[model samples]
Target: MPAITVSRRQALLGTATVAAAAALSGLPPSRTLARAPFAAAQAPYYYRFAHGKMQATVVSDGILPLGDPSGTFLGTSKEEIGKMLTDNFLSTASVVLEQNILVLNTGDRLVLFDTGMGSSQLFGPTPGKMLANLKAAGIDPKDIDAVVATHAHCDHVWGIMSDDGSRNFPNAQIYISQADFDYWTDEAKLAIKEPAFMNAFIAGARKNLLPNRDRLVFVKDGQEFLPGIQAISAPGHTVGHTIYMITSDGKTLAAIGDLTHHQVLLLEKPRIEFAFDTDPKQSANTRVRILDMLAANRIPLIAYHFPWPGVGHVAKQGDGFRYYPTPLQMVLDQKG
Candidate 1:
C-alpha cells in the first residue's frame, strides 16, 4: 500500500480547526466533578519533623510587616537595599518577616525558643498568632518546660506575657541573656531617647520581664541550660542577642534567633546593618563571624525571622553568604 502522510500545512490547519471548534462550543461540563465552595483560609501554619532524637515543630506566630525597607535595614544605600531585594524576587516597598517559633520535644521536656509578639501592636496585627499555632500543633502552652529567648527585642520577647503582665508560659522557666534582660528592662533606657521607638521597646521589656524576674535564668554563653540545648552569645543585633545550638543524638541544629533578619538582605550583604541593632557595626561583625563558622562547618540553622519554618544551610558567596532553605520534611525521614 502507498504511504499516506499529512503535510505540515494540513496538520496546522487541522489543529486550528479543532481548537476553533472547541472554543466556539464554550466551557465543558463534567458529569461527575464535585462543586465546592472556595476555602478562604489556609491550613495550620505548623511543620513537624524528627530531628535525630528530638521532635521539632516550627510554628508561626504570624507575619511581621516591617514598614519600608529603608527605615528598617540601614548602613547601606536605600538604592542598594531595594536592588538586593528586587534581585532576590522580594518586596522592595516593605519588609514582611515571618516568625518561625521553634519548639523542641526532647524525650524529657518541651522547650520553646523565642515567643512571638504576644499582644504587641508594635508592628500591627499580623503577629501574635503563636499561641493559636501552638494549639494547632497540639502543644499545650502550660506544658512548655522551658522558654528560651534569643533576645529581648519586641518581636522576640513581647509575646512572653499579656498586657496585664500575665505569664504566657506560666509553668515554664525562662532563659534569656542577663545583658538583654538588664538592658531592655532598665528604666534608664527611657532617658536616652533618640529613636522614638525606643520608648515602646523599653516599656514592653519592663512590662514583661519585671514580673518574671524569679523564673528568669540569665543564659550563660556555652552553657547547657536545657537538655541538648546550649547558648552561644551573638551580640550587637541587640546588646545580648544569642544563638542556640540544639544537639540530639549525634546531630545538631542552630536556632539563630535574630542573627540575620532578612535572608537575602543580610546574607547577601553581611555588613548591611539593621536599624534596630543596639550597635549596628558590632551586629554586622558578629553576623559575619557566626555565618562564617556555620558555612565552613556546613551546619544547618533555623533563622527566627526568615521564611516560616526557616530551616536551612548557608554557603560563602561573594563578600557575604547565601542561604539555602531545606525542603520541609513532611513525613518521618527514617534512614534505611
Candidate 2:
C-alpha cells in the first residue's frame, strides 16, 4: 500500500474532537482508568546494621504522637521550642517520637533490649506494635535469650507480658536494674496518690515483671547483663535507667534508652528537663555526661526515642550537642 500517515495537525485535531465528544457525552477521558486498590498501609518496620561481629536489628514498636511540647518540655520558651521544631521540619503543634527496640544477635544468643508498650492504650494507637515488628524481623519471642530493660518505664517494660498476663518471651531471662524494679514495684511509693498514670505504671510493671520474677535477674551498674553487654549507670530518668554498652571485637555501641527524647530539643539542649524524669537535674547531668563521652570517643549510640532506628552519634557543637545519625555501612577510621 502507499504511505498513509496522519499529519501532526490532523492527529491533534482528532484528539481534541474525541475529548470534546467524550466530555459532551458525559463520559470519562480515554486516558482515565478505574481506581486501583489500596496497597499495604506500611512496610515491615525494621532496620539492621552491624555492630562489630554482632548483628543489631532495630524493630520499631511504633510512634507516640505527643501533644505540644510547651507543657512537657522545660528550660526553654514554648515559642523558641516551637521554632526549633519548625526549623527541623518537624511538627510545631505536636511531636512524634519513635519507640525503637533493639535486638542483637551475638552468634550464640539473641538479646532484646526493652520490650515496648505491650498492649497498653496509655500512649494511644501507634505503640504496642513491637511484637509484630519483631516477627517481621524474623525473630520469635521464644528465640529471644534475654530481655534487658534500661528502665521500667511503661513504654520500655510493658511488653514483657502477653495480654493474658503470661510471660511473652517464654525462653528468655528478664534483666533489669534492681533500683528501678524496686522503685516502681514499691507499694508505699505506688500508694502515694500520684498521677493516675503512675498507678498505671505500677499496675503494668506488676503485671509484666512480677510473674517473671523467678526468671528476673536484677543487675546493677557496671554488671555484665551478658558476656558482651555491660550496664552503664545513667540514672535520673529513672532511679536505675542504665544504658547497655555492647562490645565485641573492640567495637562498642551503646543502647541509650530514653536518655534524650528529641534530638533537636533535648540533644541540642541537653540541660532541658523532661517532666517524666524522676529527677530533672540528675537526668540533665547524665545526658550531658554521656553525650560528652560518646562525642569524645566517637562512639555510636542507639537512642530509644530518637527517630526510627535511632542509631547515631553525639557531637559537641559550640558548647551544645548535636545528633549525627550514622548512615548504614559508615566506617570511621580509628586513626581519624
Candidate 3:
C-alpha cells in the first residue's frame, strides 16, 4: 500500500535484473533472435486450448534469460537455490522466464489479458514479439473487444501502444485495477529518482496507459467486468495486482499473473522473498494463500511467466507444492 519507489541496487536484486543488465552494461541487442520468431518464417508461437466453452490462446512473446539467481532470490543462498534447481532438473546457473500472453474468446467478446513487451528493447533483444504472434494466432488487434491488464508492470502493459506511441488496440476498451492505475500514473511519485531503467518502466507505463484514459475502465475486487470473467485482488507483487478467474459450464481456470516467477523455487519455497515485489512479505502471503486454494480446489492455472503455454495445476507436497503441467489436448478449429 505504500508508495512504490525502486532503486538501481534494489532492481538488481529483483525481476528488473535483466533490465538493469541491459541498461548498465550498455550492451548491444544480441544478434541472436528469440526462438521461433514468426519473422523468420517459423511455426506460429501460439497454442490453442479450451477452458470450458471459452477458447484460450497462449501466445509467446519470447523468453528472457536472467543471468543468475543469487541476490534476486532472497532468504536463500545461491548454493541452496542451485540445489533446488538441480533437484527439479532445471538450470542452476540461469533463469529463463517466459512471457506468455493469453487471449480468450467468450462467444461474443474477444478478450486479451496482459500484452507482452511490444517492441521495447529495454531487456535485450529477446522480447517484443507479441504483436506478430497475435496475428499468427488468427486474431487481429483491432477486433479485440477488451484489453484487460492484471497490473501495470512494464512487461505487462508496454505492448498496449504502437511504435509511434498510439493506441494499439483501437477498438478495445482498456481495463485495470483502480489501485494500480493510480499508483503508476502518479507522475510525481515516479519522479523521485531511481535507476535509469526504472524510469523507462515509469515512462512506458504512462505512455501506454495514459493515452487510453477515456477508454480505461478501473475495476475492483470481485467485480465481473465481463460475462464469465471476474477479478481476484492479489496484491504485493504490485499494489492492486490482480488475477482473473474464468468460469463457465462448471469449469474454472485461474489466469495467474506474476504470482510466482519460478516454477521450482517459488512453488517449493513459497516463503522465499523476491526483490521485484513491491511488498515481499505481502507477496509471499498472497502467494501461499492462492496456491493452497488452487491446490485444494484442483483448479487449472495459466501462468503469465511460466513455461510456454503455462497451463498447469498445483499439488501440495509436504511443506511445499508441485506443478503438474496440463498435457496439451487438441481442439478442432471452429467451423463458420
Candidate 4:
C-alpha cells in the first residue's frame, strides 16, 4: 500500500466545495449523500489482489428506492420498524436498494459476479451500467470468460442478455446453482403463484434461461467455482439461494445476496423474518447462524442490498449483531 497521493486529496477537496454550494442553494445534490463528495473523489472503484495473480474490483451501477411496505419484515410492527431505521440513522419511510456487480481478473480469465439490472428496468435509464463501469476500470465485457449467478433473480440474471435478447457477454459461459435452476424452471410451481410480481420473476427466469440451456452450467454447494472462490449453501431467502466466498492471502470475503433486505433490522432482530423470504423461519435461522459466524471470525461480508461499496464486518452487540462498514482505507487495501 502506498501513501495517499496529494493530487487525490486535492481533487477530493475541490469536489467537496461544489457539493457545499449545492447544499447551500437548497438544490438536490447530483450524487448520493451516503458517499459524500470527498469519498466520490476516490474513484468509484475498489480493488484487492487475490490468488497471487488475480485482482477484483467492485463497481456500482446505481441504487433503487424501496418504498415503505407495511409488512416488509414479517411479524414486526411498523412503529417498531420505524425506530430501527432511526437508530441506524436511516430514513424510516424509504430504503435504498443498491445494485453492485463485481469484476474478477484472474490474470488469464475475466469473470463477473452478476450482470445487474438491464437497461430497460424502472430503476434508471441506464440500468445495465456494468459494461460502462467495467470500461472505467479498464475491462472489456467481451473479454469476460464467465458470468456466475448467485441465483436466478431478475436483477441478478437479466443482464445476461441485452435489450434485444442478444447475449451481452457473447463469449462467456454462464453458471448458476443447480438447485436454483430446478426450482425456477418448474412450470407447475409458476402456476401456483397468483401475484403478478412473482409471476414476472418466473417468466423472466424461464425466458432468460431456456435459450441458454446448453451454455448454463449447474454448480453444487461447497464446490470451487474458480481457483479461490467456493460456493456456500445459504438458502431460505429463496430455494437454493447461495453465497460465494473468495479467499486470498489469508483473507476471505462473503458475497451474500438478498439475505437481508435492510441490514439494520435484519441484523439486530434475526429472529424476525421478512415477508419476502420464501421460508420465513428458515431464513431467520440462516440469518442468525451466518451473523454469528461472521462476528465470531471477524470476517468481512458484502450484501447486494447494503449501502454502496457494501463491504463490512459484523460484530455481536447484545443478543444480535451490528454491521460496521469497512473503513475506506481497509476497503482500499483488502485482497479480494
Candidate with the greatest TM-score versus the true structure? 1
Candidate 1 regions off by >4 Å?
1-35
Residue-pair clashes per candidate: 1, 0, 0, 0
Instruction: Name the lDDT value of residue 250 in candidate 4.
Output: 68
1-336, model 1: which lDDT tens digit per residue?
Answer: 223345766788887777776667773432244799999999889998888889899999999999899998888899999899999898888899999999999989999998988877778878999999999999999999999999998888888897765788999899999999989989988876788888988988888888888899988999998888999999998988999999998888999988999899999999988889999999999999999999999889999999877999999999999999988676777541
TM-score ranking of the models: 1, 2, 3, 4
Clashing pairs in 3: none
Which lDDT values do the candidates have, in the order given?
0.89, 0.87, 0.85, 0.75
Which candidate would rank higher by lDDT, 2 or 4?
2
TM-score, candidate 3, is 0.85
**Global CA lDDT computed for model 1:** 0.89
Flag clash pairs in model 2: none
Candidate 1 lands at a TM-score of: 0.89
Per-residue C-alpha lDDT of model 4 across residues 60-133, encoded as one tens digit per residue = 66676656745466677888888888877888776677776777776677878877776646454645666677
TM-score of each: 0.89, 0.87, 0.85, 0.80
Q: Write the per-residue lDDT of candidate 2 for residues 278-301, one digit (tens) a residue.
A: 899999999999888989999999
Which residue pairs come into collision in candidate 1? 118-159
Clashing residue pairs for model 4: none
Question: What are the C-alpha RMSDs, in order, of all predicted structures?
Answer: 5.5, 6.6, 18.0, 11.6
